[model samples]
Target: MTTPQDLLIIAMDVTSSRDIGQGDLSLALAGAELVDLIEAGALTLDDDRIVPGAAWTLDDALLSEAVSSLVRQEPYESVEDWLWRRGRDLFAAYRAAVEAQTPVAAGRRRWNPLRGGPAERADSPARRRAEDRWSKGDPVLVGLAAAVGIEHPDGEGAAPADEAVGTVLDAVHDAETELEAVRQRRSIENAAFDNIWRAP
Candidate 1:
């Protein structure tokens, strides 16, 4: 499975006190897609700008779409610009894509006293691969997961070896931090508005 798909699966499987924000997840997913594209030689980073390589035919439909959406003109998009533009509602897109691929049960099951209901997700190779990567502390995966608030048990993983991938990861972290700041400002503004209305 693709990194974006694996990330979405992990986010869904995780249980955290603070809910994962879709905006943060979307930015991270965009970063993951860029990392995979760089690994595949589909694109390269000229400084912080993304430079598209020769036309590529990706096997994954969503990835192919990502390639198609690249800003091919001169002075290509910066990593931060790409994150905000392409990442818009990206979490919902990945969620829908994953849900469409998952199999649905046709028959209803009888209630059981001892055993729990069917598992949320069937045991699958994709999930196994994701879990393995997560457990092994794959740097890129770990970095992307952390951007979305998924902490590693043994602390943060090492930084990515590739400079370009590291650039993307850094952009993801900055974007997530900026999003969080926006949330805090909104929360404070909302609280102020409530206090004003409640004042005698």
Candidate 2:
């Protein structure tokens, strides 16, 4: 099965009309990777920190590598930091995977002004279905679309889309907020300790 991150790349390719901005797409891909890890039970978000979870036995190579990297890092890492460092590479990986499966005719490389370089855009029945699944409220798709700023309706009637979007926005906001607080507290604590060390 194609992972949520893969599907998201396809959706963006089809919907962006060859004008996908690299910055936001990278951010979305990075966020999707984290979401994928969380779903696989390999990692969990505790406020601003990403905590290692149970061993992941998944066969997905990319996700497995991500989990390994996370585990090898210090006890915890901030979500924003991870995303900033890894988003572009993850987005590139997704783009490569899509092009490998899709024919050159259906998925074409063209100049993307937003990217300031060549970019791939894919159009196929599978891509269409990916979008449809998102609109129908496949939870992963919905969350990913929301995370990446894609406009996919929840389709559960009037309130569902709003609620679903709200949920994702809240999660991202809360994570960033908590991580910032942690950084601030640590900075203060380190400064006080530094004073003690200097006193001697």
Candidate 3:
């Protein structure tokens, strides 16, 4: 009497029962992990995984429980798609913040005494390029901050004077509550799928 369709219904009932007994929301991860295991099959989606897109399938509709588990994990390639997407890495954020604290100029980096250096000798392309690169270091860092969404959170608001890089990082750091919610959701989904996949 255990047809494939019936099997899905059974799994749902079983997981629901476990969920009720545990009483702790964190315990929901077991159920989610079950579904993940099943969907992952022989390959995983983590960095160690060599074969990409192994879990890109619709096998969970047949599972009696956690149909949404399969559906959720399928679209997690980019940071924005991750259930708990964090800010870009720390080095990136920090550099952005520092850059925001400073300012610089563009164009051929000529050695101007105003920049705490002696005047460049005329016709020296090497010195000119070197000066330009050195003077633009802070600008480059500021650009990094901009790339990391720094204009709004690490240290201050996205304003004319605020250090956008640090402000962005700060904002992201302050989002602990939001991050927790994403983690909890992912945990629960993973729990639902764990049992479906296993070691060889």
Candidate 4:
């Protein structure tokens, strides 16, 4: 089954023309993965950092790896730090999951001189499912779409402003803000976080 992280990545492809940066997309997928874990009862927020719970033993290898890395980190990084640290790998994993649905070129689009057009990632059917779910107010999809600044899926022309979705979006925003704050604190700190945040 396509996970929430897969849907979020696919949504980025459907909604944005410009490439979503690695860091940005990674963080977003991290947030989505976190929410997915929570929904599955595998993880929870303890002081705003993800902590593994009953569902930590996920069948999905990518999520299992993410949880395992979170478990091994020191000083108990906040959701933002965890996401920032794990962004690339999480994004890559989710990208693979999404691409597995409809195989496509790796990374983003490229100019194909012979075809005289851009090489594109395959359009994922999972994205359509997510969009349909979002229109029906699937909180996970709504929350993720909101986090990525996509248009509300409801077609009523407004993203959910409800407290639950608000809370999820807030967590995502907090992660991003925390990363930015760390970036501004010092160059070495930024470099350090960048280097060691991701799981090996």
CA displacement after TM-score superposition, residue 44 of candidate 1 (Å):
0.4
Off by over 4 Å in 1: 101-119
Candidate 2 vs candidate 4: the lDDT winner is 4
Per-residue C-alpha lDDT of model 1 across residues 15-73, encoded as one tens digit per residue: 43355767878899999999999999999999999999988789998899999999999
Full-model lDDT for every candidate: 0.82, 0.57, 0.29, 0.58
Best by TM-score: 1
Ranked candidates (lDDT, high to low): 1, 4, 2, 3
Lowest lDDT block of 10, candidate 1 = 110-119
Superposing every Cα of model 2 onto the true structure, what RMSD results? 10.1
Q: Give one digit per residue, the lDDT tens place, for model 3 in 167-190.
A: 322332334335456768999889
Candidate 4 ranges with C-alpha deviation above 4 Å: 17-19, 54-56, 72-75, 104-128, 153-168, 177-200
Model 4 has a clash total of: 3
TM-score of 2: 0.60
Which stretch of 10 consecutive residues in model 3 shows the poorest summed lDDT? 17-26
Give me the displacement of residue 144 in model 3, in angstroms: 21
Q: Give me the candidate number with maximum lDDT.
A: 1
Off by over 4 Å in 2: 2-4, 13-19, 54-57, 71-75, 104-129, 153-200
